[model samples]
Target: MIPKLAILRRSGLLTLALGVFFLYQSLKLELGSWNEPGPGLWPLLLSLLVLTASFVLLIGNSEGGAGSEKKPFAALLRDSRLPLAAIASLVLFIVLSRYAGLTLAGGIMLLAWLRLLGKEKWTTSIVVAAGLTALCHVLFAVALQVPLPEDWLLALWSAGR
Candidate 1:
């Protein structure tokens, strides 16, 4: 294994360790039978999946590659737009949802993420945003019958209705 690729193995080992730690932590939560999954089930499964992937990444080929040095954390973050956009989206989503209601806030946030941050085509962004909004509606409003916030828009909507 090239020395550079060894970084990947070490990094993967760290991630695998963290995944294992989370998996262990998740075990403390209730793990219901397969027929009735408890809170721990999803986290445990996800952690196990992460553990598997990290292990694979750690051991995978180093033959065809230049074992490049890892970028500095600051440099990595400076080069990436997604993290900042995601954080902004969260803050904007919360504030927008407070006034606009879930549907509008969610739609706008998804649009911003897809179009601006993700650099998706307009048609694709719009479709994805609409689909996700509809999916959220179905999940929370229709299927689960969960009561959403009576934000300004929702209040006005109910008042008019």
Candidate 2:
């Protein structure tokens, strides 16, 4: 059986791979000039952040949550439904974002993560999700002048105007 620590390490490795992929994709886009930033700037920065975090996770000290008990990896995989679901939710968020703006997708994703994964109260989850979504819009769309994907609802509204 694989030790819990090993599983954690493996997860870190997986994260690292994902981070690398993001970085690579970001590199393909134009990393615009400052003041008149290009679309790629945000993605590039975000991907680098992911890379850094994943690297830290990979090398970080062993934590208490992952038990020291030696168990088969299969068992670990079988017992990781929540983690798996979280991952799936992330994929959903991405797909949703492609059609719906980040505000909507991010709100839904944040709400799910907070309420389901964090097991927070629904009111708390809703409040946080709304606040965070607004904050994200202000940061990315307003402050940074980054264009986010147009959600169907927003697109429809604009078309009607």
Candidate 3:
């Protein structure tokens, strides 16, 4: 079993790779001027943010850091809970988005992380998740005119109309 710090380093590396992939994918799409942002602009910015964050994580937890020492098996297991939860949540988000759409999936994931992982109050978690989801919707779908994964709820509503 890998030590906690090694796991963190590997995760950082994985994130860095993902960031690079996203950046490349985003660059394939048209990147319009700032005043007239294209569909790819938001994704480009997000990918850049991911790259920056992953680099920070990698540098902060480098081999020489205090957390680099090998920990006991039990301690390593305990320390891995957060990272496992994050990975699980990411999987959940991907699967859920395919069925429920990005807005709902994002909201659910955020709520779970904030409430269960972060130990935040239910009300606070719900509010923050909802707010963030709404903000994302407005920014991506409304303002930037980016096409998101088809939303089941919206489809149902449209069918009903």
**Number of backbone collisions per candidate:** 0, 2, 0
lDDT score at residue 21, model 3, on the 0-100 scale: 95
- Span of 10 residues, lowest total lDDT, candidate 1: 72-81
After superposing candidate 1 on the true structure, give the runs of residues whose Cα lies further than 4 Å from its correct spot: 1-7, 62-119, 144-161
Quote the positional error of residue 56 for candidate 3 in Å: 1.0
Quick one: best lDDT, which candidate? 3
List the candidates ranked by TM-score, beginning with the highest: 2, 3, 1
RMSD of each: 7.3, 6.2, 5.9
Query: Residue 34, candidate 2: how far off, in angstroms?
Result: 2.3
Residue runs of model 2 more than 4 Å from their true location after superposition? 62-90, 131-161
- Model 3 CA deviation exceeding 4 Å by range: 65-103, 121-161
lDDT of 2 by residue, 79-116 (tens): 33455567789899989888776778899999999998
Question: Residue 2 in model 2: shift from native, Å?
Answer: 3.3
Best candidate (score: TM-score): 2
Q: TM-score of every model?
A: 0.52, 0.64, 0.60
Candidate 3: worst-modelled 10 consecutive residues by lDDT: 71-80
Q: For model 1, how does the per-residue alpha-carbon lDDT over 1-161 read when each residue is reduced to its tens digit?
A: 44544555565676688789879999999989799999899889978987886666565523344765544432333323354466579779989898788988999999999998878999999999989987997798889999988656446666999
| lDDT for 43 (candidate 2) | 81
